[model samples]
Target: MSAMVDTPAPAPHPVPRRTDGSSVPIGALVPLTRPGWVEAGRHLLAGIESGVRDVNDSGGILGRPVELVVRDTAADPRRAAAAVEELAALGVAAVAGEYHSVVARAAAARADALGLPFLCSSAVLDALTDRPTDWVARLAPAQSHGWRIYGEFLLGAGHRRIAVAAQQSVYWASGTRVLREHLAAHGGTVVEFDMDALTPSAVCDALVDHGATALLLLTGLPEPAVSIVRSVRGDRRLDGVMMGAPAGQPEFGTWAALLGEDGAGIPFLRYLPERLGPLGARVGTALRERLGEAPSFVAFEGYDTVAALADLLGTGEVGRERIAASWAGVAVEGTRGPIRFSRVPGIGVRQWAWPPVQVVDRDPAAPGRFRVLRTG
Candidate 1:
């Protein structure tokens, strides 16, 4: 994060508007480049595309075909905001899909200002808007809701002195706060180590010095997180300490691909049930074929975002008003379960209230198999 500087705005790019009445275009904001998690974006898009295919196959929504107008945010807030502006000008029925919490926050603010209905797919920051508005709704569980569950899991595991290796970001900071507050209330303590300021070995040394029984990696992937995990795992002094990633980093295949056996036994939160329902099983199979792998919970969020919208627009006019009204009026069977939005306290948008919450890890005996430890 650099200091803000005043600079002249660049000339606006001309956006081509929809000139034909062939299909209903919906805006998709995804991260397809660096700094954004491209793997997650691929899965999310696969699910949304799969949902769109299902919608069209079953005789399109309101008999009108659905079109996805995609713009890559690359995890940049400014880029996401610009995409929303362009989508609004293009006359999209609604805007949806975002994986980064900060980027989703920026897009949410822009959609609120432009009065475009937004169905957020994956980003789960609790307060998405500065104020409440009917223009925005979310499909994922709020950060506070999920992270508090993670805190409880840690306490149940008897980790009283927990340490976190963190970086500066609104999403990470919020998760840290949730853990700190929830754990403190239960006679547990949280120790903070700034990953940006210390090397991996230094973090391990500090964990030993502080007598922390557990260390949570609240940082980003592939660099500091991987390095820190390796350092701590190899340190003989910290052999008995547990490692965790409450943000669900290890839920993805890349974690096992990179860390192999070392990635096992580190618990993380995931929004999935113990067993998939009928719809979940069917969609999960389609998503696996579409993505060439198993789908993550983020992918299911994407599918549900579009599927719920299709349910709302049944045999009715497709416009901003109906989409906005879907916040309270629509009830659809999501891949996870029944999907509906309502007012949840402290969340500045319509929310699903919750998706399933689970604390899971890769099985130590079988690194590819995920073992569920607890569910909320």
Candidate 2:
């Protein structure tokens, strides 16, 4: 009888309660970027918005409807930080946005101050992880990873001497620094050349003076980077040498004819091409149908950021405290690989690595179609 009386009471079971109790499911505030950026973001947001709607229509996030709160960050860090604070004011579950690393960092700082969870969609600067803050997370890979890929490929391809060309922009400069470090680590050397002078003539002159075996173009768009490639190739001064990085833009096809065989040595570090599947194709088609353009890395990042946050919100804890706790090791089967927050301080943001790709051939008639060469 005494032994039988020792049975412990059964633990209470969790009663399924609505996670959306007078609270919005999830919200996002994106900095209004350039026309191209805005269009790209719109495409990404379209897919993400559709996905979110699908979830809400099916039953919503824990029975709460999800909402997207978009604000114009104008691609400015100050405005971006303000945008996050404004979103916090809305009592949103989480805030995700901005493609620039600098801007994202600024927003992250603001989010941390407000004790909100942040997911930076496209910022890739490795400097982002210099300090570890809990509220900030990223969805792009580190600059070091991208640079390491470029450096490894160059070294492996027998190009021991490299020169990095950039437009004096922060992004390009950062890439140059990281690439140089990686190149040095691989027993290679990198000479940095400034492309900020804008004119093709001036850029060509600089490249001629700073001759190296290969060139890494770290500018944002294909046009600027391609222009430099064409100028250098046309002058015949940059012949035999290779060009690389962010040059992986599809516009390389258009420049291929101008570059002819010269472009063959050119390679670019495109992140997450593996994720460019049916979803990407569909989003691209829809973007073309509605906006008369296709999505780029910008759009893809935005879509991914929102899609991830919406799914997290669906799990029944939309508050920043709860979401942040879940985010540290939360893995999502993203268009990229498993995107999760690193438990490490500044490095805890989301990061992805993609196999490097080169343009083997460009469509003779198409503007942005290219055949992939040796993906690594």
Specify the highest-TM-score model's number: 1
True lDDT of residue 177, candidate 2: 75
Off by over 4 Å in 1: 1-21, 315-318
- Put down candidate 1 lDDT per residue, 83-191, tens digits, no spaces: 9999988987788899999999999888877778889999989989877777789998999999998888899999889999999898989988999999999999998
Q: How many backbone clashes does candidate 2 have?
A: 7
Per-candidate Cα lDDT values, in order, are 0.86, 0.60
Weakest lDDT window of 10 consecutive positions for candidate 1: 1-10
- Highest lDDT: give the candidate number: 1
Residue-level error in angstroms, candidate 2, position 252 = 9.4
Q: Estimated TM-score per prediction?
A: 0.93, 0.78
lDDT of 2 at 213: 71
Q: State model 1's lDDT.
A: 0.86
